[model samples]
Target: MSMSEAHERRLRRATRILDIPGMIVGKAAAWLIVPMVGALVYEVIARFVFNSPTMWAYDATFMLYGALFMLGAAYTLGLDSHVRADFLFNILSPRWQGIIDGAFTLFLFFPAMYFFTVATFEYAATSWQQGERIPTSPMMPIIYPLKSVMPLTGALLFIQGISELLKSYYSIASNRRFRDEDGHP
Candidate 1:
């Protein structure tokens, strides 16, 4: 293979490797919606039909929703599905786009995610250490498990961010927009 083709293959391999964790976690997290819906429906039926309410449902729904939202971020980012003000961006050349994205990822995205991971890591550790519980309901479900998802989500995003950085590198090197593994731009 030519040097360029070989380099492209390496980049593609790295991206695929980095993408796996996010894809797995994101897909698993998506299943949270099923249980969340079940909890809500159960709560509604219990409260209305039987004049009884559930304490666990409120906590369950919120925790599940939060986990789903956070966990799906890396996958969304991998798919290049995140919201952005891309009106002018869409019109830019691949090299310029790569430069802009690389700069942002290097300067803005990296720092933000780094700090987020650190903070959430500490938060989760403390929660776990304390055996924290959600005080909002008498059921008082242990919240450390839920809190742990924050750092995990951050780590997942950070991993996907590396994949993005690799794509940016490919774009900069090739002077073309990087296509995904499936050949989508």
Candidate 2:
């Protein structure tokens, strides 16, 4: 194979490998809806039919929803499903698109996610140290577990970003958009 062809194969391999974590984590996070829905349904039945209320249901639903949203971010990114103002972007040539995407990933996405991961790690550390609990609810569910998801989500996004950056570089070198395994650009 030519050098360029070999490099493209390497890039594609890297993309596939990096995509695995987001796929697994994202699918797992999607299942959070089950427990969240269960909590809501139980709350409704308890509050209305039985003429009683549960304190933990609200907290459970809130935390589950938050986890689902945060954890799904990297998964959505892997699918290239994030919304962007792509009117002007779509009109650009593939080389220019790669330039912009790679530049943004290098200069913007990396720095922002780095700070986000650091800050969230510290946030979760403090929460764990204090054994934090939700003060708003009577049951006072432990919040440190939920807080831990923040840093984890950041790390997931960072990993997925590496995949995207590789694709962007491939696009730059080939003067064509790099397609994922599913044939998506």
Candidate 3:
């Protein structure tokens, strides 16, 4: 196989593996919403009817909300659900848009996320070292693994972004949706 063919296969394989994580993240994200809403309801009921609030509810809600937001990001990006400046591009021909997508991802998306992932990893590492937890609610200890999700999501997003970048490049190069040579089209 030619180098491009080999590289394309590699990208597809990686994307397939990455998609498994994306699926898990998506499902986890969906489940988080249930607890987020439930926590709020429980907190309200506790304060009103029982005249006391659960200590951990506040912390749990906060953490759940954070996890929900962070974990859902990559899944959203993978679905192309993100909003962007597509006004001019919408007017352009599809091929031109593909070219622009490739160029923009090369110049902006990858570089920006490279730094974001690195910095988030450092921040999460510090939190882990300190054994950080929610200060306001002690019962809900800061789980270092939880904080680590920030960097993990960032990395996932970076990977998905690269996949989209690859899609854009392939669209321009082959004048088709990014797909294998087997006419998976």
lDDT for residue 73 in candidate 3, whole number 0-100: 87
| Model 3 lDDT per residue over 1-185, tens place | 12277776776676667666665787778799898899999999999999998887887788888888889888877666678776765676545767888888888988888998899899899998998876666595877877898889888888777777766765676555553434242
> Candidate 2 on 1-185: residue-level lDDT in tens?
12376877778888999999998999999999999999999999999999899978989999999999999999999988898877888798777888999999999999999999999999999999999998877898899999999999999999999999988887787778786546575
Tell me the spans in candidate 3 whose CA falls farther than 4 Å from its real position.
1-18, 136-140, 176-185
lDDT, candidates in the order shown: 0.89, 0.90, 0.76
Task: Please tell me which predicted candidate would have the highest lDDT against the true structure.
Answer: 2
Better of 1 and 3 by lDDT: 1
* Of candidates 3 and 1, the better by TM-score: 1
Q: How many backbone clashes does candidate 1 have?
A: 0
- The superposed Cα distance between candidate 2 and the true structure at residue 62, in angstroms, equals 0.8
TM-score of each: 0.92, 0.92, 0.79
For model 2, the local distance difference test gives: 0.90
What lDDT tens digits, residue by residue, belong to model 1 across residues 1-185? 11277888888899999999999999999999999999999999999999999878999999999999999999999888888887988788878888899999999999999999999999999999999998777999999988899999889999999999988887887878787546464
Lowest-sum lDDT 10-residue window in model 3 = 176-185
